[model samples]
Structures are given as structure tokens and as C-alpha cells.
Target: IAEFNSSRKLIPASNTKLISTGLAIRGLGPSFRFSTRLGYSGYISNGTLHGDLYIIGGGDPTIASGDRMTVKTDSLFAKWTRALRVAGIRKIHGHVIGDGRFFDGPIENDTWSYNDLGTDYGTGGNGLCFNRNIQTFSVSPTTVEGKVNAEVTYPATPWIEFRNCAVTARPGTGDNLYQFNTDLAPVAELRGSLAIDKGQKKESFSNKFGALTCAWEFAKYLEKLGINVTESPADIDPYDNIRYTEAWGKDSTRTGFRYGNMAESPENLTLVYETKSPSLKEIAKVTNSRSDNFYAETLIRMLAKKRTGSANYDSCKVVIIREMDSLGVDMSYGAQIKDGSGLSRHDYIAPEFFCRYLKAMSASPVFKQWLYTVGIAGEGTMAARLQGQSESLKHRIKMKSGSMNGVLCYSGYVMPSPGKPEDDMIIFSIMTNNCPEGGSKVRSFIDGLLMRIAK
Candidate 1:
């Protein structure tokens, strides 16, 4: 008897994916798939894929680098390029065509607050997104000609630009930045240099930087690796292939490719490689565990299309609402969901209502097994905190933890005692909204509460 609702309505954080995912499982079923295909608009001669190489996206958000699906390495086109070159088709006089017509409406969420746009959380929903709209930059400090030299993950070409204002001063505290005046685009434009004091240790920072800007990068990576290309690609009408299909995780067991053989060397030919990402379960686990903003948002939008039978979010929201209604959960109260991962401070949800959803999840058999993995004590969001605590508690805690600036939330199942499993079964959702003490305090409090409950 936690009296969960008394804690207040909090921003859902990544817990929102739970709702989106549950709704997806119900509306789209467990076997659903978001697929991307390679289609030819031109003809082939001598086995050369002689046409505009079209990268047709079925709105699969799990494509390209940093997807962390264990198999979602950013070398699909590169591998395919090598495969094509081996198969003998070269000299493509066309542009790398990436098609993103699967979903409709503007890719970016218009309602997202202005403050979020520049960050990784505010990525665009484009027709073609590679690696969830991010690029990793590895920064290391070195001295160059008495000036400090820093190695950044710059584009392979001289096209993409960075301006760092780092100076070779005594190794100490200095902020290093490649401040671009404008947004990241596919086009290459290196603006300014760094301004960093040289004495500091070679600290590294990795960010999910850029928009859906890596499509060309992927394409370029493939082409430079000698993948045979036909011609310039033309966008296909998504309306032509819009259909309710089973969802597919990157590791579709039906496909026979192993998980880790994705690395490839790219050449100037055209090729197509199928990269396997981790299962949806793994993705969800990591998303919830890390409160990963980028992955959660991607999966949510993709889930919207999967559940609603529509690619647009407006209609997708309707589908989600209807699905939730089927479970006797009403959203009229403090449940306000503006985007997928509830990272938005605007997202609101009643802890009691969330608990109700958690209860319903417990009632489902298909989602039950996967359910525990996403929860606490299952090597997920709460694994570290719940370690050694679950054994003494005996209830087998499974939970999802969420937090933003001033909000913290948890929703999942717990057993009061091990010997009395049936009687011990309990579902709880706790949320702290606008806590004057901030999110860390609320989270620490939750940890304390869990430990107390365990004992």
C-alpha cells in the first residue's frame, strides 16, 4: 500500500515508451515489423543493379550507427557495397537515393518546445534517418606546432566543417567546442575553429549530434567502398506500399544473418547490406534503462505508425488512446503525452493510472516474459539499484525508472514476499511532479523506498 498517487503527477520521462510500446503490442501484435527495402527504378544488365538505387524506408527507426542494438552497426551500405562489387556491377553515374516516404507529415514534431530543438532529444523525423539522427565525436587533446591539436570525428571529406577555439595553454580547465552557427545539414560547411586551453587532460565527450543528416554519409560510406550503383535515386510514393505488416526487430530470427558481422570496407561501387539490430526487447530495455532520449523517441514514432495503421502521429495518438481505453484506463486526468519518451517536461501522468497500466501488463501472457526484462532486477533500468535487494525481498521486482529535471517516476510490479507469491503480487507506479528538491532527490527517495519495501 504505497499510496502511489499521493506522490503527484510527474513527467513520464522514458516511461512513455512503455505506453507506446504496450499500445503497439496490442494494436500491431507481437510479430509486427518496420521494414526498409532496396528497390530498382531502372534495369539491370550483366547482373549490375542498373538503375537508381532506391533506399526505401518503411519507417524503420532502427537503421544506422549508434542504434546499439548489438547488431545495428552503421555499415549496412558499406557491406552491401562490397557485396555488390564482388558481384560485379560498377560505375554508377547516379546520386545515392534515400527514400523516406513511408510516413507522412513533417518529420519533426511541431509541438516540441523550442528549448529542445538543438539537443539530441529534439531530432527531426525525416524520410531517411541514419543512426537515429546522431554522429559520435571523439575528442582528444594533443599539441600541434606548439598549438594544441584535438582530434575530432570529422567527416571523411573536407566538406563537413568544424570550428574549434582550443588554445595550447597550460593543461587545465577550458571548454572545447566546435560551435557551428547553423544546424547540421547533409551539405558540408565547416564554419569556425575551437577555443580550448591546452593544459587540460584529453577529456572525451560523445553526443548524438545532427539531424537525419547521415543518409548521405551512409550512402557515401557505401559508394566509396565500391558498391555498384545504377543511377540517381527517385523518391517512391509511400502510399504505394502502405500496409499493416508484422513488425520486425533487427534480429528477426527468420533472417539467417549472424549479429556481429556488420563491419565492412566501402568503395566507390553501389551495394546493399542488411544490418541486423537487436530485438525490440533489447532496444526497449536499453531505452528505458538509460533513459535514452534518441532511441525512445524513434521507437515511439515508429510504434505510432505500427499501432494506428497510419504513419502520422496525430492519427497514431488516436490509436494509442483507443488501445488504452480498451484496458479501462482513462487519459483525461493528469495523463498528457506530447511525445514518445516523456522526456518533455510537458508530459504528465498520474501515478495511479500508470500503475493501472502496469497491472494490465501483468495480466497479459504474451508481454509478460518480455515485461520482466524491461523492469528492475532484470539487468535493465533498475538492475544496478535493485541488485542484491531483490533476493531478500523475494517479490522479484521488475520496474522502469524515469527522471527529468524536477520529475521522477517508476512503474512496474513487485511481490511482497517470495513464499507467498500469489498473495504477495502487487503493482505500483510512483511519480513526483515538480518536486522542489529536483529529480535526483526524488530518485534517491525512491531508492530508499524500494530498499525499505525489500526488507
Candidate 2:
């Protein structure tokens, strides 16, 4: 209904997920599902496996994710344990391996800010993501002044060492704690302070060692079940070829096994069990509704892998451009798509492109499924937006919100009326970058604009 600086390139923040998600639906189809397999090499005899048990990651992002749409971690692990029991294997003479070489790239985008790299939302995508690639810790103030205590509380990070340096602040000061750690580092330093009266608070930090963490957690779980694991948990490392070859061997058994990339399993690997993720439709819903960076980044890489046989951020950019071109959506107007989740400040897209993309998706074969991925006025990120408005108005506004630092953006379709046809929907995008105002004020302005559009 209105437009200003529509062609100007601006940071879209999490709105970038819409582009990745749309391409995923168009390229991979809504029914597509990611798979993770449980298998073993060598032989099993007398209720013992002589070789390593493998959790081959198929780039399934939802495994052990704490989202409402996914299965619980313990429940999923139990199924794998049952599969081992059913196979009459009670002892493993080798290490539990997590093969996460499905996607070949750096976990975190280089363009992402260093500060964001340590936060939970900044967790990078990986072949075998567990617990959303985050580790949580409970922080509380101690009786001693200026003293505090912190402890790891989830998914068991026995490999990680915590160096708590946080102090206790005055009452009503709230939480100001921050976690700092290098990529794949075993030592993490907790800095900042917590309020004395704040009681206990849970803080989540990024986990760069997702694949190794996955292996370690599963090994612990197996040990709990009386399964003897003689060796430690290991993840496939590109530089550590000696260890890789030693684990699987270099004989005729290594026919289909390729170093560095394990997308294709070894020929002699016996399939114990397989875990299938929720369908792409369900995943996309969670991606946009929660603005999940992990899901979006993983989806884009999966698309790239499916199209060009390479799963990396560079290939993802190529696939996105090609797919957008196929849809006749012009992105040549100063648009830079650095990462799928828009965590990078370098990502820029004209608001006009979003409107065009949304319009094109409205006519797509999977339009109905794609529509379900965005946030409605009273749901997800839009829960508090346009509050106290009529239900009709609230339901008609279906869009995704993106906010970080000084950027806030919204883009989606606004229904013309209740139960109206897709053709009648109004596609819109409002992007605000480098605004000095607080998020609430910017959100209020955008909500007012949307309410007017709904009316």
C-alpha cells in the first residue's frame, strides 16, 4: 500500500531467513526430510562390537533440538540405545564417533561479529547439531560479597572447562554475565556480574564443538546403560587423517569411505538405526516463527549440497542466486546475501526484493506450506505486536520480524480479508537500519503501519 526507499539496500537482520527458507521450499520441496544414521564398522560377535559405532550426520538440524516441534533428546537417544540392544551388542571395544563432515565449511560465518560468536544465538551450523548447538549453565550469587557460582546444567559438557570470573552485583542490577570462548576451545571464561538478589539464572552459550559434543553425550548415555565403551568419543577431523584411517582401516573395507567428507558411508557399515527429522514444512515453520538461525543456515547449506554437491556458505550463495533467477526475482540491485540467518552485519537486501519474493512465493505450488512458516500477528515474534487489536486484524498480519543492534525489519503478506484467496494478499516489507530509537519505539511504528495496512 506504501513504499519509501524500497530499492535501497539495507540490513534485513533475521528477515534474511525468508529468502533462505523460500529457496529451500522451492528447491527441496516441503516433504523433504533430513536423516541421521546409526551404524557400526567391523564385526559384532558375542554381544560385542570390535569396531567404532558411528552416528553419521546427514545435516539434520533438528536432532536433539529443544524446539516444541522436535522429539526430546533423551527419547531419541533411548531409541538408538534400544537399536544397539536389539542387535545383541552390549560392549563397544572402540570409540563412539560422530561423523559431521556432511557439510564442508567453517561453522561460523566469517562476517559475523566477534561478540555474537560467543552467544547462544550466535551458535554456528554443523552436520550433527545437538541441543541447538548451545550449552547452558546456571549462575547464582554466593553468600560472600562479590562472589558468584556457575555450573554446567545441560547436555553434559565433560570435555569443557569453565573458568568462572563473574562477580556478584548489587540487588536490582539484573544479569550482566557473558561467556567468552574461542571456537572449539575446551576452556570457557565466564565474565561480568550477576545481581545478588537475582537468585539463579540460566545462561546459554554457543557450542562450536557440536559434532564432538554429540559423540560425547551419546557415549555417556551408553555408559549409563551398562554398555562398556573402551575408548573416548571422537569426531571426524580433516587434519587428523591418521586417527581417521586407524579407526576405520585402509583395507578393502574402506571402499566407499572418503576422508574429510562422510556423506557417503563405508560399504561394510551395518545400519543399526536411523533418525529422520521433522519434514521440511515443519522445520521451516519453526525457522521463521522462532527466527532460528541454526535452522536457516542448515537449510541453505542443505540446498547448496543438493544442488551442487557442496555444502558451504559460498555454494549456498550461488544456489540462492540461481534459484531466485529461476523465479525471475531480480537481486542484482545491490543485494548482498552473506549468510542465511542474517547474523552477519554485511548482509544487505533491498526491501523491494522481499516484496517481489513474497509475491512470487504466493503463486508457488507450495504457497500454502510456505505461508505457514511466517509469524502471524499474535504468534511467535509477533505475539506482542499489534496487541489489543481485533482478532481479525491480528490474524491478517503474517510476517517475520528481525532485530539486532540498531536494525529492525518486517516482511510478509497481509491478508485482504478472512478466508481470502492468496492472490488477494498484500505483500509488504519494511526495513529499518541504523535507527537510533529503541526497539519498542521502532516496533510500535511498524505495528501501527501494519495495523493501518490491515484496516
On lDDT, the leading prediction is 2
| Residue 241, model 2, lDDT | 34
Instruction: Give the TM-score of each candidate.
Output: 0.72, 0.91
lDDT scores in order = 0.52, 0.82
Ten contiguous residues minimizing lDDT sum, candidate 1: 255-264
lDDT of 2 by residue, 268-309 (tens): 578989889999999999999889998899999999999999
Please provide, for model 1 over 1-455, each residue's C-alpha lDDT reduced to its tens digit, 9 standing for 90 to 100: 75835535667776787776666555544545556555434455665555445555665556664544544444565565565566554645443445565566655555666445534455555445565654445444455423345443532222233345544433454443332222223122222223344334433222222212333454545555555333322222223321110112221112111121111112332435443345556665566666666556556666666665555767656765767778777777757777766756667777777877777766665465447346555354555464445354533666777766666667776655646756567776766666776455566677777666655
User: How far out, in Å, is residue 359 in model 2?
Assistant: 1.2
CA lDDT, candidate 2, residue 393 = 82
Residue 156 miss distance in model 2 (angstroms): 1.3
lDDT at position 441, candidate 2? 82
Report clashes for each candidate as comma-separated counts. 47, 0
The residue pairs that clash in candidate 2, if any, are none
